[model samples]
Target: MSKLTFADMQNPLFLHPSDGSSSIQIEKLHGPEDYRSWRRQMEIILTSKRKLGFATATVTRSTEDATLGDQWDSCNNMVIAWIHTNLSPSIKKSVLFFTTAREVWKHLETRFALSNGSRKYKLNKDSYGLKQNSTSVYDYFPTLNVIWEEMDSMNMLPIITTVSDEVKRNLEEVEKRKGESKLFQFLNGLDEVYVPMRSQLLMMNLLPSVETASSVIQQEELQRQLLSNPRHDMEMSAMFSRGQTGGDRVVVCKECGGKVHLSDKCWYVVGFPNGHPNHGRILMKPGSMNQSWSIWNKNNPGNKPKPAGNVAGSASNAVVFSPQQLEQLMQLLPSLSKQPSKASKTDDKLDSHFSGMMSYHNALNNDLGWIIDSGASDHMTPHFQKLIMPTLVTNLTPNIKLPTGDTVAITHM
Candidate 1:
C-alpha cells in the first residue's frame, strides 16, 4: 500500500460511481473473437461508474490513511469482480484470481490484442472480397463500413502530445491513399452494370471520397429503379391482359383487343394512360369504331352501310392493268421532268411525246381538259366518255344521296 494523496483526502468520494451505484453490467466477453469490442464495452461502463481508476492503476492502495487504503482495496476488489462476472466461464478462470483490476485488464489486453495478426488478415481479406453482388448499395455500404471500422481500430496510429508537420503530411498522404484505395475497392466490387458509372468516376480530375462515391452510386441505383419501374409496369399490364378477373372470367376491351379492361378504358380508343410511352400517337374516335369500319375496310364483305336511296350493283371493279404496271405507267410523265438532260432537245421531239400521251384518251368532240387523277377516292366528272370500257353493275347496289335529298343510283362500273 502507498501513501494517500492530498487530492484523495480532499475529495474522498471522487472515485464513487457517477450514478450512485457500483454494480457495473455488460455482455460476457467471448475471448479473442470479440475481445476488442468487449474491452470497449467494459471500459465505457467502468468510466461511467467512476471506477476507471481501478483498471488504469491511478488509485493505488494507500496506508497513510487506513480509511483511504480500505476504500481503495474495496473498490479494487469490486472492479476485479465486475470484470470476472462479465467474462465467459472459461475466460473467468484465467483472470478471476488476479490480485488487482489493472493487472487483470492489462493481462487480457496482452494475451488477446497483441497477437491479432489473424483478425487483421481476415478483415483485410473480407474487405478485399466484399461485393455488391445481389445486395443493394444501401446494404453493401453499411456492411463495408463495419469491416472498415474494425480495420481502422487495428491499425490506429500511436497517440502523441503533438505531431510534427512532416509526420502530419505523411499521415494525411496515408489517409488520402487509403481513402482512394477504399473507393477503388468499392467501385471494383460492384456488378458489371456499374461499369459506365465506374468509368465516369475514374475520369474525374479530383477523385471523390468513399462517402461521396457511395452517395452518387446510390443516386444511380435510384435512377435505375425509376427506369426499370416502367418496363415492369408494362410486363404487369401484359400479365393482367392474360390474367383472370375476380370471378375467373377475362374481361376484354373490344376496341383494343386487350383483356382485363373494357373499351371505355382502352388506350387505342379512349386515350393513352399517363406516363405511357405512346404520346402524340393517332387515336380512334369512339363514334367511328365498328359502325363505319366496313366503309374504310375495302374488303367489301356483306353488311355494308345502307344507302339512303336505290342501291347500286356490285361496285367492286377489277382494273385492266396490274398495280405494278399502273405505278410504272404513272411514273413515266413524272420522270420526264425529273430526268436530268445532257443536252436540250428540239420542241418537235417534245411535241411527238405529248401526242402519244393523248393517244390513250379518245378524240371527243367536247373541249374539256382531261385530268388523270388515279389517287382520287371518288370521281364525279360530268363527261362520262372517260370510261375506257363501260360495264353495267346490277348484282350489288350502293346509292349515293344527293345534297337535295334525292339519291342518285350508281348505273355503271
Candidate 2:
C-alpha cells in the first residue's frame, strides 16, 4: 500500500504481553487471507525499523527434518534468519520498529497494571533511581501515551513536537486574549491539525492565471475576512436578577458594545442582598443612639475639633474657629443635628443577626456558615430535625444541655 493508504502504519493488535520474560510470538497461519494479514503485519514492522526478535519453536513432523529443527531451536536466531534471508531490510526495519513500539507498549502496560493493582512497585537497581512514591504510569500519563502512540503510528514525531510547541504558544495567546470568545478555542485546536497544510499553502505562488487555489486558510484569516465583511458574532444580553451563586455574569464588551455572559468567571460582592432597592442606604431606628447623634449634629453650630499643639508648642498653626468654619463643622456632623433619614422607614426590615431554621438548613446544604453547637443532643429545630435526621452525623459522646437547659444530640453531616 502507498504511504497515504497506509497512513496509519501501526498495528492495533500488536500488544507485547506485560510479563518481562515473554517475547512476541506469531502463530502459524492457515489460509491465504490469514497469511496475507500476517505478511502485512511483518510489513508494518520491517518498514519502520530493523532487527526484530521473536519467540518461536519448530516441531519436527518427520525424522528426516529433526536435524533441521535443531538449527531453529533458538527463537531469536530463527527470526533473524527469516528476516535477513527471506525479507529485505525494509521489512526488517518495519519488523524491528513494530517490535520497539510493542516493547514500549508492554512497558507501559506493566506499569499501569502495577499502579492499579499493587500498593508498592519494584524496580531494577539502577532504574532511574526513583523515589519511593514517584508518580505512576496511570493518571494523566496514560492520556499522554495515547498521543505519543498516535504520533508514532503516523510517523509524525516532528509534527507532534511542533504541534505541542504551537499549542503552548496558542494557550499563551489565549491567556493574552483573556475574556475573549469561547469560540477562539476551536480555532486553536484547528490550527494544530492544519499546520502542515497551511505551511504548504503559504509557500505556493499566488499567480494571476490561477483561477482558484487549494488553500489551508487559517481561522485568524477567516476571522479577519468576516470582520471586514461586517458580519457580527451572535450574542445575547440577558439581564439577570443578580442573586445567582455562580459567576454567570453579563458584562458589556467595550469594543462591540455587546454583552458577553460568562458563567463562573466573575466574582460577586459578598453580603450584598439581592433585589434590594435601598441596599446602599444604612438605616437606624428613629430614636436609636445613631439617630440621636444625627439629630444633635443638624441642630448644633459648628464645633470642629482642633489639632493639638505640635512639639514646638506653636498655637499659631492651629486655626482659630470662625463662626462660618464652626457652622460648616456642625453641618458635617449630620448625626448631631438632623434626625435619621425618614426614607428608610418604609423599606424592608433589616436582616437579623441570628439565622432562622431555613437559613441554618441552607448553610448545612452548602457546607458553609454552619455552627455545630457542642452542647446539644438531637437537633433543636423541629423542622431541621425532620429534614436532616436521615443524613445527620453524630459523635460517640452523650447528649449535652444548652444554656436554656434543653438537650439535643445530633450534628449535621
Candidate 3:
C-alpha cells in the first residue's frame, strides 16, 4: 500500500468519523447581535467533529489517562483554532488567556446570553419600534428576521407541547395565527403606497409565505411603474389605435392654436381679452403702452421721441407720437419730471423688503399668499376674490401703518 501523506490525513473521511458530506463554516461574530448565530454554528461544527464534550466536560489532570488527555488537548486546540480564525481582530486579544474550550464557551455565553433584564427590555423595545421606512422589502425583511431569530433563540415565542392529536392540532393552530400576525406586522410597516396590495393580501383565506409575498409585491411594483409612466401609456395607445396605413392625425385648434382638441373648447375663448364676443379690440393699459413706446424709441435711435404726457385714441386706433410732436409735448408738462414724494419712495422700499422676507420665510407652499401686518386693527387685501367673509367696509377707509412704519389706506377689508 502507498504511504498516507499529511494532505490525505487532513481529508474529512480520515480526520472526522462522520459521513464526509455536511461541512460547517463558522461566520465571524461581529457583536452581541451575532453571538446566538455564531454559537449555533459552532455547536454544529463541534458535534460533527465529535468534540462537543470538550465544551462542557472537565478533565482531572492527576487521574486522566495519557490517551484521553491527548484527545482532550487535540479537541481544545481545534476549538481554539476555529474561534481565533473567525474572531474580529479587535476582540481576539480579550479571549487569548482562555486555556480550554469549555472556559471560552462559558465566557462567551456569560458575556452575551441576553439574560439581563435591561438588555432584554431594550431588545423588545427595538423589535417593536422597528419600521420599514424608506427601505425596500428585501432589505427591511432581513432586519426583522434577525430580531425574530434572536427573540426565538431567547425563548421569547410562546410554546405549546404536542403530546396528543388534540394538543398537536392546537399547537398547529397557534403557530399559524402567530405566522399570520407576523405577516400583518410586516405589511403594516411598509409604505402607504402598498395599501391596496396589503388589503388584497389580508383578504386571502390562506396567507402566502413571506418569500412568496415578497416576490409578488416586487412584481406588482414593477407593473405599477410600467402602467404609471406617461411615455409607456402613450406608446400602448399609439400601438392599439394605429390603422393599417396610419390613422387620422390630430387637428390643431383654430382659436387657441392647440393640438389637443377642437376650437369650440379653446381656453382662449374664455380667457384672452380679444377672444371674448364683446371684446373686439386688444386692451392695453396706459403704463404698458408707454413702456412699449419707450422700447420702440430706444431700439430705433433715429426715431427717438422725448417723454410725452398721455395721448387719446379710439378703442381700435393706435396713438402715434411723432418725434417732433413728442419733443414739443415734453416742454409743456414740467411737473411730470418732478421726483416722487417721500411717502411714495418709502412705500416702494417697504413693499420690496416685505415681499423678499415673505419669499424667504414661506418655503412650504407657493400657492398661499402672505399677509404682512405690524399693528393693523383690520386685515385688508387687494385680492377681493380671496375674501372668506366679505362685509364691505366703506370704500374710503383710514390709512393703516405698515410694518416698516409707512402708512397706506385700506380701501376694503
All candidates' TM-scores? Answer: 0.47, 0.16, 0.47
Stretches of candidate 2 above 4 Å error? 1-22, 25-37, 43-69, 73-280, 283-413
Which residue pairs in candidate 3 collide?
A: none
Candidate 3, residue 337: the lDDT equals 47
Give model 3's TM-score versus the native structure: 0.47
Each model's lDDT: 0.70, 0.35, 0.61
For the record, the alpha-carbon RMSD of candidate 1 to the native fold, in angstroms, is 15.7
Question: How many clashes (backbone N, Cα, C below 3 Å) per candidate?
Answer: 7, 33, 0
- Estimate, for each residue in 84-165, the C-alpha lDDT of model 1 and write its tens digit: 8788899889886789989999999988784558888988899989989878999998988888888897889888678899
Model 3 C-alpha lDDT per residue in residues 1-413, reported as the tens digit of each score:
99889886543223445423233446787778778778888877776665566676643322457865665566566667677667777667788788987887788788766655765676667766778787677777788777666666665545555488888898789777767766766787777888899889888988986666777777877787778778977776666545422565655766545665666765545444555674653433324434544554454445533222234742222334568747655763453345345467655654544432321111121133433322223345566644444666676656766666688775555
Q: RMSD, each candidate, Å?
A: 15.7, 29.2, 22.3
RMSD in angstroms, candidate 2?
A: 29.2
In model 3, the runs with Cα more than 4 Å from the true position are 1-27, 58-65, 116-120, 156-162, 224-413
Worst 10 residues of 1 by lDDT: 356-365
Instruction: Give one digit per residue, the lDDT tens place, for model 2 in 51-82.
Output: 23232112222346764444323323433444
Candidate 1 deviant stretches above 4 angstroms: 1-27, 48-50, 114-116, 158-168, 222-413
